[model samples]
Target chain A: MSRLSRFLKDNGISVVFGVGFLLSLIGQAFAGRAEFNEELQSDGARPVGFFEYVATSHFAVDITENWQSEYLQFFLFLFGTVWLLQRGSPESKEMHKAGLESDKDQRVGPHAREDSPRWAAVGGLRQTLYSRSLGIVMLTAFLGSWLAQSISGAAALSEERLRGLQEPVPWASYLLSADFWSRTLQNWQSELLAVGSMAIFAVYLRQRGSPESKPVGASHDATGIEG
Target chain B: MRTIARLAVLTLVVGVPLTGCAVPQDRLEAVRKATERFATLHTAGDFRAACALLTSAAREEAVHNGGPTCAQALADAELPEPGAIRSTDVYGRQARVELATDTYFLTSFPGGWRISAAGCTPREGRPYRCLLKGD
Candidate 1:
């Protein structure tokens, strides 16, 4: 029992995230198939097999749009935190201390702890680059997801045009069209709203044992540091 | 009362020219032919030729798939066979047709009656249950 508690304390987040991701994927497959079948009936076309629809850009676009927004949320939050601060919010650093901090504050070279990463101790450009690696990776992933949304979105739109006995547009034209931007903007707005809420809510909210929130009794005026 | 009667007469005079021209059946025929030709090209696996016949909406879709040149249909490997119109029922600018394997719903375009949409199903448990194709 003691060992189990210790293991969960160390690896709780990784487990929850992995399990939730897999379950949602399965749910999407089932729900997507149902929706595809509805369209098929509406078009008078035969309902496609489950796996067949799964391979198409229809499913690809659906999944990528979701992934794009999630990555966008994370990427924006990571970088935004560096430049913006809410003085009393645990979710943000102090207002006066915006932007990159000094080397000693971040711990580098001889000032590094014994357990500090090798790159942090190496200083120079390597240390500087490593300092922002999390945001970089998240931003790269968001860009990739957004690109995939464009490609897959074009494919889905083309299929609809073909089915409608209409001429298809060029990829460049589709990218510039109202249809593509509408889809992107709709998803982006929701993610922005959610992230903005989190930043504000975490200021006075407490989730007890959750690392996402400060201690239950912590002052609403507390800033930057976690419980 | 006299002014009101005069205004009513004037309104009737203006309403006479308000009706728009109806779409001609010949135009619908031309659009149907164009759509059929495109479908024929697709079934024959001559995607480039088929793509050329595609309406603006379909053409946009094809271009997104890679260069609007490939014969891949339905995003699945299964190839749909080309079919001919068995019979057509035209009403004003709208028409529904029964093809060899599917039913097509059409609307008149500038050129002729073109299929606005088409749906296909197997022979048994066929598309008839949910379609408006035949009489």
Candidate 2:
């Protein structure tokens, strides 16, 4: 294959999602700017330009709130699946294989295959870190995004309060406010529900060739068997 | 590890507005000074000077209210003394300065911070009612 084609093939999933995210973000900017300008006009304030609106706390908070929740969902899933078992769900490991398996079972240490990751072949802190790296990274992203949401949300809330002739709150106060919790919980509940539903649905559903689903001919009780 | 680091860097980049885009202290101080000057000009009976400090929108509204000029309208408004500055809060291009006796809302323009509303009194669950306000 040509270099361009080889690169595309190797990174197709990321490229697709990256492009989709950019398009969606652009769409959000246009829609958000229009809605923001409408409210500004109604309040007798000057309308902001598209770039200005995008840079505002109003936009930042909205994006960060959703991003944080998504990272939280993946973080929970990655950590939860390590010990939790769902008998019929391909999303989970086999029921008998629950909990952290032996080092040999994980192809670590003496049992490491020649193709195994270097850290997996090592024994000590590096191996330990590599084992939980997925969960660690997801958790880190979750915390970072949550922090971003809080900061941006506080700024947005302060602007609204100032517009209403109320005193603008400090970051600590805003973090404890109903507005902050409302934004967080609203996104969180949706993400949690979607993840839970997907886990349960995968037990009975078959998506043919998708790894997320069991094979069409597979039994409903078959655990940890991906198509 | 590299992927995680890249993800973190990307998030921080996106978080620029949240992490370090706070309204600068210098900008807040400039607004505070402008507010004090406005109150000082009004208290000194320099209505024209005070009127000159009003935002264009506010000045136009003041002029159209009753008097033919912003100065005449402001002089007729009978605003209370602002006294010493108590506190000032600046968010983005907007600011609110609380004086010992009154509150004022200011908006930043290319020229500088100008009074959008003066002689303001807060109302519960509503925007402040002001003797001089932009339309």
Give the number of the best model, judged by lDDT.
Answer: 2
Per-residue lDDT tens digits for candidate 1, residues B1-135, read 579645643432232112111225665566467657756655666765654443344344434543433334322223345477776544323345567776555554455444344454434422223121211
Tell me the tens digit of each residue's lDDT in model 1 across A7-43: 8888888778978987998899889989977985685
Kindly report which residue stretches of model 2 are placed more than 4 angstroms away from their true locations once superposed: B1-10, B17-21, B60-68, B121-129
- Tens digits of per-residue lDDT, candidate 2, B25-71, equal 78988998899898889989999999999977889899889579889
Label model 1 with its docking quality class.
incorrect
Span of ten consecutive residues with least summed lDDT in model 1 chain A: A161-170
Real interface contacts reproduced by model 2, as a fraction: 0.17
Question: For each candidate, what's the DockQ?
Answer: 0.02, 0.39
- Evaluated at residue B123, the lDDT of candidate 1 is 45
Give the worst 10-residue stretch by lDDT in candidate 1 chain B.
Answer: B14-23
TM-score, cand. 1 vs. native: 0.62
